[model samples]
Target: MKRTGKRIISMLLCVLLASALSTTALAAEDGKVLKLAFTDSPTLVIGDMTIYHPSYAAMLAFKGAFEKSTGGEYSVELYPNGVLGDAASTMEQMLTGTITGSTPADGALSAFAPDIQVFTIPYLFDNPTIAYDVLDGDFGRQLFEKIAAETGFRVVASYDNGGYRNFTNSKREIRTAADMEGLNIRVQDSPVYLEMVEALGASATPVAFLELYSALQTGVVDGQENSCVTTLGASLDEVQPYCTLDGHLLGLAFLVISDTWYQGLDADTQAKVDEAGREATIAARGICRYAEALAVDTMVANGVQVYSPTAEELETF
Candidate 1:
């Protein structure tokens, strides 16, 4: 009887210890792994410079570095190429805690942060370098921090997309806004883009990026606006002929995460994660600028009717 009672006590103790260990693991007092979903298109093809594309492989570099640096305790689950949904949907998901993070263009994020939309306004910056200083400086940080406090989203880094340049399949070179009359320009589904295209006198059509090439080929739209990198990265040269260096607006992207999911992490882990994201953002931006320069040179060499408007020609807009 004594032996049996001792055996039963040992079994009960083992069970209790196991349950306690399980609870501790679940609580993750030390640290936890993080999964972040980004906006991207599923069928978007990759290129030699795809790694430098802000929304694609460049993000992967961020994810890898964060995971490796943290010794696997912290990690990201990147949903590239819109596997999660469009930029808007992805942002919504992050807000609801269904997703941990996202990278959306400033114009796309304007619906959430109106101040960010200001960057998309016409003639916002003379060039990418000036834009970068504004974004990485104290004013940008304060603005982003305010956005986070007000909107329950955290902006870790500001990413750079290529300059918002214009392109067309039509034969005429657009030297002035008057030349844009009656042109059906395909634009990303952003109100800022729509407004700007309207200002330039084109009938702007909102279309997803993947469908743009086919749209231009079949006359669904007569032209579009994007950076040199996107024009080449997407192989748009196959369809669009007249590439214009309008430099209409500066483009900016952000690596954002849900405040709720982020707050759930311990402070130390969160700091490391934030630092990693910042590094990734800087790296992605640099990669984009380099890729854009190369894309422009390559496109010019490939018989693209590249147009540089004269100083007087640029004033019509």
Candidate 2:
């Protein structure tokens, strides 16, 4: 009788522990956590760059808008500064439902959707306005649908990443394509970037965006191309003192969520998520444009040489 009682007690304790764990899990799921990850510092203004980095601000906007629209039924948790990992990894996590969403650069998306590489072609969009119009129009919706069908990811929103990409280096200022020759340049882990850099007469070195600073400081690459906002936000000016406003590529970012997860949400929640994403997109674009406008002056004030090529000189490329 004693042994039987002991066995019964053990079974009861196991059942209770299982019930407790199940209840905890259920509570967490009921909270409807939306985890968004990105790889940029929360603060952009350190010296002359006086604006909150859009990545952080926009995520906050998304969180606030979603919670407000949902009447606090959902909670958003943001992981900035690559806390969740770099773009590629975070995107993978999102794909597997390990993360709810992520804002990855266009180049990063190319890995999963090869068609996205077309956007990375140098000078695809002449200006931000054109880019915005195209992205926010029917074409953009169709493209998103195609991507969803192909990758199980839905692009919830699109926004300017930094306006335009330019070359920055510690070696010297680049004035023409000739100037790029013989210099090893760090390019994003995308073939289009590699081809673009090489076509510009530089040796293209593929590097993760998170490790760019160390790569530049250690002379792994002589230069890198990025938007002024990214250059300043990452403090690349500290490592690279020269910048040429070549504007080779129009930078863009996409806020993507797992289509599977999104489909699971009810219609009301889905609409709320879309609304929040739109708000976040606007916030990101505003800050990016503001930063781009001030970036040249800011970088110059911060002891980095900023140069704009003459039309004739620009044509030399």
Candidate 3:
């Protein structure tokens, strides 16, 4: 009887230990640090200012606030400056739960959600305010929810990159669509971008951002289309002398986190993350706008002539 009782106690102890281990594992999975990655660094400028280009900066603020809100139960890890490859790759990682978050623009999201292309349509937005009203208001929020339903990413913040324009190395200014005939220009590898460039009557060469300088130096392409901030930030102004202020399209970036990872976070903590994202977005937009104006002023001061497209000349594209 004593031996049988001892054996039964041992079995009970084993069951209890197994249950404890399972609980621990469940807790670990439930509250692991959220890992975030981004393609751009903090100093990247899109429009008039330098946005904290990575989602990490915003995530950091969220982490602290979330931990406080949750009584120190949750945390986050940030990997900025393309540590996990390009934005698209990082986004893939987010979906797979390898990384938890990323910041991607409308152009980047177009791959998974083609409806996003509507925002990419050239000259669709007249000014920043209208763009913000559309995106931050009912339509943009609805699009975000739709995209989240289709792709498992959630949007927490919205930011402006810039108003897309053009710059060229040639002495002849691009006043109308006719001026772009046969001119070789660089663009990002997107079908929509190709369409826009083709509409402008220029041969579009898709090139990565890092390789653009060499391409311009070797005369691989005559010029490229980008915002004022990017043109000067990347030092494209040195190789390309003329800048056309066409304001062809505006760019907006979203701070997105994996839906699975986000769902794991408690409600209060999630709210904190969303709030921090908005705060960082405001800071980034301010920096980009300021940087764009500064870049234009600085470049013009340095003998780079800048011109705006005439009213009639703007409608060709």
Model 3 lDDT tens row, 205-278: 99999999889888898888887767877888888878777778777777788877777766866777777666
For lDDT, candidate 1 versus 3, the one ahead is 1
> What tens digits encode model 2's per-residue C-alpha lDDT throughout 64-148?
9998897656778888889999999999998788998888887788779877766777867767888889888988888888998
lDDT per residue as tens, model 1, 196-245: 89888889999898888888888989888888877876778877778888
Ranking by lDDT: 2, 1, 3
Prediction 3 TM-score vs. true:
0.78
- The stretch of ten residues in a row with the least summed lDDT in candidate 2 is 46-55
What's the lDDT for all of these models?
Answer: 0.74, 0.84, 0.74
Q: Candidate 1's error at 119, in angstroms?
A: 1.2
Q: Candidate 2 clashing pairs?
A: none
C-alpha TM-score for every candidate = 0.77, 0.79, 0.78
Q: Report the candidate with higher lDDT, 1 versus 2.
A: 2
lDDT of 1 at 232: 78
